[model samples]
Target: MDNSQRIVTIKDIAQELKLSVSTVSRALRDSAEIKLETKMLVKEVAARLHYTPNPIALSLKEKRSKIIGVIVPEIANNFSSNTIAGIEDIAYKKGYHVLIFQSHEKYEREKENVQLLVSRRIDGLIISLANETQCYDHLTDTIDKNIPLVMFDRVCHSINAHKVITNDYFGAYNGVEHLIQQGYHNIALITLPLNLSITQNRLNGYKDAMKKYNLPVRDEWIIHSPIDVVCSEMTIRRILESDNRPDAIFISAERLNIICIKVIKEMGLRIPEDIAIAGFSDNPITPYLAPALTSVKQPTFNVGQKAAELIIELIENNNTTTQYRTIQLDTALDIQASSRRRQ
Candidate 1:
């Protein structure tokens, strides 16, 4: 490339304005050292020249980017999509751009994505960790780098970071309690892997509700299913075909609810007749499903709103004192035919 094609810099702006590099830089940033007239002049000239501040140079000088990185376990899911939209809305309004990355629900993928975003000189990071993530090496890396990070939904307990989550324990407990109240003594829990903290909370809630009501809690009644609809369908089908069929099932996660219904339909079972179901889901589709799925509706919109607010706070505050913050929202059970008692 010719020398004329070289990128513009603060020095170039200084030379054009016949001022020192420090003066030009200060003027560009509107620092108090520069006069109001000089600041306006420098800014106008820089804008006219279409000068773009190099993030690398700015990061080296200012120690942070104005942009925030957002990582989701899977962007395809409704909950993630909605949460991301909320983050974007807040980030954009606060004069920050969001760089979104999908982890595909894999630990290695999540680790790689976090590292890559950090490499891009982001000011802060917001993440909903993957279910498969068990270790905290990558999350701890953020702390070591003095970067502010906030975790939403699936979070790490070992690492002390800011977290925003729904009340999965109460949500699951209330869901199960509602089912028991409706005469569902034999209740099963359709859930994600118990290794995840969110899953464990919901499962604990289930156990607590059963114990409180003096209902039998069978170990085999807990069925862990894959995120895939087909795989979940097959797993639920196996459970349904077993000799010890549950009278009602508490879906631990909303995504698993979709496949559970298909499995119920395949068995030619009448909902609330042969079996009853209640799921943890925040999707609008729940109210429209066949039998209008009774579900534990997570405050999805609020979760998104709060996640964005926390990330914004982290970025603006820039105080990385290793303070652990956890925000837990409430969830409501939407009653429908699935968990209704027989007349």
Candidate 2:
């Protein structure tokens, strides 16, 4: 017989060993009721036959696939990639597999990814909502179906689920405070749309810090630009060309920070000498910039680890009645040459 013609099964092993199919099954699973000798014999025969357990069949029987789905806005960013690494590390240790999906900051894509992951019968889901995702119907549907869900980073507060996030308010406050301590009074802010929770928190922090130092909060200096390179460049140019140009700028997003730097350099402005800058970033390249960037770094990896842990716990317990949790991790400020005044 051709070796690849037919797949080996427990029934075939049972017939060859003169044992019942149930006995073979128990032996293969190493059930406590099965004898040690029988289990060993079954393993050896299964190995020789090149038999493999079918995950599909097992999932149908146990009602679990042992796979978790993860959705992020984009995987190319340093933050998302670092978070995924942390999640994979924990999931691997716990014997669960991860399926990743990227939404590319589109609302429709985010919804579609959720549906696909659900159709695969994943044990649970971990998500960081896209900037364009405002609808909660798809998310609520997962809860109705009793599938565990955890949200991290960009999340919706209306959805009742386990959430892991950074202390954006304090992180932003620290960044702006550092600028003030360095004698930057006329500070500007480049941020995302006001609809996002992270943006709101960070904006509040910036405002509070300026108020604390009695610095004028110029409304014109605050530019609300999405994560578009063209829009960011235009907005930044307007701020730089204005008659009351800021002496320092605080960017809320890492990508925006990079754009701000590019704009500053293109305008023949020298870092710290002409204008100082600070923002939120975790890119390793921050330290190697023309003037090493000063910025706030969140515990991105830890956020992913905690999100995975929570989702797995919810899956294993299947405890619908248990209260959901929201975890907020701390952030750190890395002060570099970019934000300091020239001696």
Candidate 3:
């Protein structure tokens, strides 16, 4: 009679009420086959006994855990955090739970997390690829196993999974064009490695904008830096210190924008006076900077919400013939003092 040490089960309820285990299960699930009186009695007994269904057992029986896994590069970033909030909002309302994992931009860690989530039999997965991820065997393996997966933000083009992303090319193009409109001819670009699709698209936009305005794209002005802060700082310093320095800078990443600003301050350069700046960001702090930065703000929350909706639909449909989709959302330009030239 040690209630603290013993857990209640369907068998326990059945034995106490002198009913079959199947009857207890059916009643608990509110099946139409069970009489109303029996269903009410079983629910009352289950509540009184503090009985809870085991998720593992139920998943094994129904082949669904009603849980989805999410993987992001880093949750501390404002963009990632906002996206996660949107995902949670939709997932909660749909009667599902979300399990999150941070890849820290490491390829091995991302692989491990995907494997762990798959082993746990999650209904589906939502992922943003790590910066260091060059090979995508783990992602393809999930598809081979017939598990629904959705990739958002930083995704793999080789994978045919459903995707949600912003218009990186147009965002960068508009940002660079804003600088051009502000009468800054020599515009520099600080971007991530070209291997990434986002990086490539944004870079192409910058080039196209420069070409559109009949401005020459200098080789040295197009600097490629890793996602590391230290590396970005060094690269920014070298660019600013050079004799043929640019009058305006276009940063392609959020973190790189912060680094560029820090470097500018350390060198005692005034914003929009010495050099104007613009970048990609959705951080609230953008408007509060010493000279508020002009930025291309992607629809971070909508991206996450749409990704969750797609994955859940795929999970619920479980139809092998269902066609996948890639949803690309728009970005807005938030113009401010940083990128404006003082007349």
Candidate 4:
């Protein structure tokens, strides 16, 4: 009020309202300690003056960064990018900042990243487990340290915590069963790190579907590769060139689908003509691909939003070291030209 026109603060509101700073603070925050009339008046005045609380000050007082650290397998992956965007959308609205880290699918890198986030004094964490992350000691340490953690997409089953994940088992099993229905008996599966729960679930789904259909499931039909373009493409090429070629291929991971497409193109094979294909992907471009790829679409954006909501709830309630909840969201099968039977 004494200087140039500027936004209002708690002190300014207190001065105008002729109340104590603490009372004004409580009123503006709608704390139950303040009288209802005072809260309404303070809220009305604060709205008029456009007074916004300084999160930095609150962060310092609370010994929190008001920041949520997000860990992903790779930033460049479509699913990871979209999921992060969803997380940020919610985090920003809740007056939180996100510090993103890429583990590059390495367990050591993931551990180091989590430690760094902890050292930075982040209020909470949201993570998509790395392919190589089998051990949950580092994750368990976060819970022990009283940091709210919400795992999304790829989660560790051993260390139970708030988890938001797609139903990988049903998704992969349905994809393979669809191929079987299309009369493709020789179905092959391409997957990433088998140690992770998502990988295991999808593999199990594939196996169960094969068993239910009485299809031959040879060990050689399951191809494991790094979650990357080069490795997946090479694996796909090897499978294509093998004497025991599969009439259909199922990719458990999204990134592997692109590599499979590239491999099929290189081999001059047509979709659903030379081989039927399906995979797990929520990539927007998936529908636009040549002979639009059939895939299992996870609710990536919803998963991110739900994870943020759960972490914030955990932080607010001071809930730690109790029974954790696992939330599994169902996936959708996108029937497209890639898996359509040649008529």
Candidate 5:
């Protein structure tokens, strides 16, 4: 390519201002050594020329890709999407790029994405575990390599890494307590695979709430539903069809909650009359529904922001992640018509 067609660089800006490349670089970075007037002039000229730093050159010089990798079970979900939006907002301000990958809730796929990100020399990683992930060896390998990593939403507790999560135990406790107060005695808990920490946390919450009110905790009521439409529908139907059908259903997360809502409508069940529904979701769609859903609202944006900040901290400041921090944020119970039992 001819000089005219080449991308403008710091050297171009320096030549345009009749200054050395180092002077232009320091001035652009606003170094104290460079005069304020010189820095101002350099920035004005750089902006006019639309000069952009070459990422490849920057990576080589700084020993960092200036890119952060994000892996989640599914990007299509509103919760995951909001978290990613928060992550990007912070990354952009900090002069870093984001690379996203969806694991599709497959353990193998998550492993492959992690490996690919490492191969690309990502400066850090922020992730949520896939539903089928049983072994955290791939993630352990990442930390063994001293790569900064932060886990959020769906996470493996045994792993030593910075994690951002909602208070699942209390969130579920509040949802179930609300149901009990509404006079729903037979409340079923629909959950993702029991392997997930969230599922277990929510399950315990339901059990504890039932015990608190002197209610029977039926073993059959806790349905371990996967994040699949067909599978969840069939399994949920089986539980509902049973003679011991529940008066209420508290789903573990948004994905399963959506499926449960569809299944309930298909069976022509009335909200809070035939069955009351409550679960975890901060998605706006809940409020717009005919009988707005009762849900536990997690801090999606805050969790994302905190996770990104932690990863960036580990990346830039070389913070020792061995002393891992598990930041558990609060959740709010959004009461609505779905679980508003009649007197």
Candidate 6:
């Protein structure tokens, strides 16, 4: 509680109304023991004094729940699981409990998860928006209720909150530059759906690199696929089988990148010699792939750690405020045989 505004107790209301503490309590509780006029008067005064009866109403004031609620799209993904590890590192060290939930890329499920976490009276919330979530009114509702909310990967910019992400644009640029340095000029970008900031940043990076090198960025070389394996395989097969197939490929999503490798090998194309590749990867098995995949590695665990630190900052702060600042971490390109050509 702020020194300027102390919590209003039933005794204070009783003193103001010239009644006993028990009488004021009964009035505020709507107990049948109290007269209707007395109950109404007490309730009015309680609201006017900014009195809060529960943890949710109090926001981050007196009582701390010491628990953080985390929501993500998929827990099975290597990226998400590693990020959760980072979050747990900070949360447990600070003596806070972590509750995890999955939205499975569905908007309705995501909304339900938020409502459930809020009802549980979590101290703060960290979320990665679902692919299907276009409206942020539900998230804004959480903010309106004075909850501390932070968004990470696949976040919506319309919401005013702290965000943590890797520099996808530069990551993609560096990955493509690796391919260009290896003498692969016709590079195709098989990216995630373009509605997201991460995917769009990566696409722009690829385009800018091609423009800087004076290489043609053809419309046919760009493919948009959601998080579906079937969609990824279909798009990869179509482009790879084309008569004018790219000499190299840049994939934006981890799962999609893995899928592209599978499709390429099945098509009997020699990596680097036929079609080289590089993109974002968190999969540990990438090194063991046939050609040892060249990849732009995101700081998944570090992103989690940073997000935990920021959300805890929001939860523990006495003053209520929203700072729409983004903390961006750099991605490292793991050069390997897939994109590296040795003459």
Per TM-score, the best of the predicted structures is 3
How far residue 259's Cα lies from its native spot in candidate 2, in Å, is 1.4
**Structure candidate 3, residue pairs in collision:** none
Cand. 4 Cα-lDDT: 0.86
Q: Let me know the TM-score candidate 1 reaches against the reference structure.
A: 0.86
Candidate 2 clash pair list: none
Model 4, 111-137: lDDT tens digits are 999999998888998999888887889
Off by over 4 Å in 5: 1-57, 319-322
Worst 10 residues of 6 by lDDT: 54-63
| Angstrom error at residue 133, model 1 | 0.8
- The list of candidate 3 runs beyond 4 A from truth reads 1-49, 319-322
**Model 2 C-alpha RMSD to native:** 3.4
Clashing pairs in 5: none
Q: What lDDT does model 2 reach? A: 0.90
Model 6 per-residue lDDT tens digits across residues 207-318: 9999999999999899987677887799889999999989999988887876888888889988878888887999888889888999889899999999999889888893
lDDT, candidate 1, 14-79, per-residue tens:
888999999999898889988999998888888878788888988788766778888988887778
User: What TM-score, computed on C-alpha atoms, does each candidate reach?
Assistant: 0.86, 0.87, 0.89, 0.81, 0.84, 0.80
TM-score computed on alpha carbons, candidate 3: 0.89
lDDT of 3: 0.91
Query: Candidate 4 at residue 35, lDDT?
Result: 94
lDDT, candidate 3, residue 49?
A: 90
TM accuracy, model 4: 0.81
Model 3: per-residue Cα lDDT over 199-280, one tens digit each: 8889999999999999999999999888778988999999999998899999998878878989999999999899999999
| Residue range 1-343, candidate 5, lDDT tens digits | 6888569999899999999999999998889999999999999999999999887777777889989999999988778999999999899889989999999999999999999999888999999999899999999999999889899988888888889998999999999999999989898988889888888888999899999999999888888986768988999999988887899998888888778888888999888789899989878889888689999998898898899899998998764755889999999999999998656
Candidate models: Cα lDDT each: 0.85, 0.90, 0.91, 0.86, 0.90, 0.87
